[model samples]
Target: MIQILVIAILSLIAQLVLPWWSLAIVTFVVCFWRSSSALTAFVYSFLGIAIVWLGYSLWVYGQTDGVFIMRISQLVFKANNAVLPFVGTTILGGLAGGLAGLSGYFVRQVTGNQSMSHTA
Candidate 1:
């Protein structure tokens, strides 16, 4: 469908230009608008990811190198505070776009049938 195609293309663009939250926005949109089946898929996907992340956390909690790497990365990004406003704006914009798309999809669904006019 054209909607899926457009979402996929935008997702790829977001991956290149945005942070991890952009992917979350995509997931939310796909889960919300595509179908109930897609919503279930999203739930299962998150469940699987949670399991994997929990396992990895338990396995790596004692690793010294991971801690050192995390600390260094934190130091490197400490200056992010200076640009927090820009980062916040970018995140909010992506969220707004995703929600707008979802709303448009639902609007089409509701108005698709003349019989559904009352519901709309």
Candidate 2:
């Protein structure tokens, strides 16, 4: 709940200020500190990144009337709808965030942190 919100907000801020991969690093650090289980970390991080990306995409779509994104969507994915590009972007961000969270959990496991539990 609160943790997920924190992850999302921090990751979004990091993404805005740093490189795109900073979202993954932010999620990794946060999940590691929180000691979340792999599944919990992945799911929460995915949700956070997906939500932020979708919200940002929607904001951009509204601001641009979908002209730029729609063109790119058509060029890359051959998508005809104005919304498909946003969906694709959200999915991509979610997948990357999920993997980063999983990697963080694995790092904790390999280091013998032993704090992550099924209850997480």
Candidate 3:
């Protein structure tokens, strides 16, 4: 819960000024600071970013009446389905954040920081 909220809120705010890759940074730092396990870090980070992207994409889809995404869906999928783009966006964001969080967990392990955390 904490990890998800922190990553989602921070990455969302960071994306306004920082680039999209800032999501990676935020997830990495959060996992590095405190995560029970590598899987937990990845799962929490994935959920966090996925939720943000889902909401953001939904809002954009509504605002533009699906014009932008419909064209993208047609181009990429060779069909005009808005759902494809939404799924792609959410999955891509989640994967990026999960991988970054996994990296953080591994790097922290390399630094011998595991002793500080009481893993479940």
Candidate 4:
């Protein structure tokens, strides 16, 4: 739980200060340090990024009345509903973070780290 929070906060900060892909890098590094299982890392990272993206999207939607997003959505996806693009954006961000987290776990495994252990 705490680990997920840490990853989310760090990823958000990095996203704000760095480029778009910073979230993936931050998630990768954090997951690598935490030594989580691939599935656990992916799920947690996906949730963290999805939360951040959705929150930010909502904030932007509130700020601009979502006109720009709606237009872009229409142009790119032919989406009529404003919410659909937001959902797609969140899912895309989650997928990126999840893949990065999974890659981190794999890197750890390749480097001779102990396999992630599950506990009940």
For each candidate, C-alpha RMSD in Å? Answer: 10.5, 1.9, 1.4, 2.2
Measured by TM-score, the strongest candidate is 3
Residues 1-120 of candidate 2 have per-residue lDDT tens digits of: 665787789988888889989989988877776745778889988998899888889888888988888897889888788777887899999999888877877888889876654343
Candidate 2: clashing pairs of residues: none
Candidate 3 segments whose C-alpha is farther than 4 A from its true place? 115-120
TM-score of each: 0.29, 0.90, 0.94, 0.90
How do all the candidates rank in terms of lDDT, highest first?
3, 4, 2, 1
For model 2, what is the error of residue 104's alpha carbon versus the real structure, in angstroms, after optimal superposition? 0.6
TM-score of 3: 0.94
- 38-67: candidate 3 lDDT, tens digit per residue: 899999999999999999999998999899
Write candidate 4's Cα lDDT for 1-120 as tens digits: 766787789998998989979998988887777745778889888988888898898888889988878987899898778878788989999999889988887887788765543331
Q: What does the lDDT read for residue 16 in candidate 2?
A: 86
Model 2 TM-score is 0.90
User: On a 0 to 100 scale, what is the lDDT of residue 94 in model 2?
Assistant: 93
